[model samples]
Target: MAQAPSTRLAENAETRKTRLRLWLNILRTARTVENALREEMRVSYDQTLPRFEILAMLERSESGLRMSALSEQLLVSNGNVTGIVERLVQDGLVERLPVPGDKRATLVRLTHKGEAVFAEMADVHERWVNDLLRAVPPETAQPLIDALTTVRRQIQQD
Candidate 1:
């Protein structure tokens, strides 16, 4: 026989609660990891996570990135990116060039010094992350990665 309406509703409610708990756990774990990384960056490099992220992004772009485009890629406001770029420029770690077509736009790229510094920092950063997540071996991590990929696809579809 088909299940009664009340029975189905109860099952749905339980599933909702389970999903909520999973979400909370994921959030907690992410925050903990982010906090640890932030502290490590500050202590070891005298830099913030955001600054590191900017450098990483710039490193990926061969010709550099437009200021606005960089902010968009980082999912941050232009003003926030402007401040960081200003500091990076001041430190001689990055340089800004005028965009050929758009006088209002500027392209930002890493200096040679910045490239050397980031190479060292990136090595240490990888080791730090590996140490932090040592408990999750490759076998266990693959399934989690697949599940998260599914969740991301579902979210994007919605």
Candidate 2:
């Protein structure tokens, strides 16, 4: 016996609903984790996630990066980046230097103080992440990582 077209359509619709629910759940979980991390950073380091992000990126780049590049890497707008960089400069944690041969551009880099502060924050951040995921079995770690990686690649391709 062959299935009717209406039955097939119903099944497809059900599958789509289930997929949408799963995607929503994934986003909720991610947001919860981020919130927890943000709280920890605020209480312990007196810093916001975006500020920490900028320092982290600058720390990784020896020669620093252009303001536009930092904005791109952080997936934020240039205006937002400018505000953060200005605050960081005022705090003496970062410096903005005019790009050689580019009068209209500036490179942002972490100062020595920024590096030391980031090092401390990085260590605590790692610990917080490990604690957050400690409930999961060690055996499931690699599979979960691989699945998320695949999901990221597929979505980016789209």
Which of the numbered candidates is closest to the native, going by highest lDDT? 2
lDDT of 2 by residue, 1-158 (tens): 87779978899999999989989988998898899999999999888999999999999999998999999999999999999999999999999999989999999999999999999999999999899888779899899889989999999999
In candidate 1, list every pair of residues with a backbone clash: none
TM-score of 1: 0.92
**Which 10 successive residues of model 1 have the least lDDT summed?**
1-10
Model 1 misplacement above 4 A: 1-4
Alpha-carbon error at 18 in model 2, in Å?
Answer: 2.6
Candidate 2: lDDT over CA atoms?
0.93
**What is the overall TM-score of model 2 with all chains considered together?**
0.89
Q: Could you tell me every candidate's TM-score relative to the true structure?
A: 0.92, 0.89
lDDT tens readout by residue for model 1, 1-158: 87779978999999999999999999998898889999999999999988999999998887899999999989999999999999999988899999998999999999999898888989999998888888898999999989999999999899
lDDT to native, each model? 0.93, 0.93
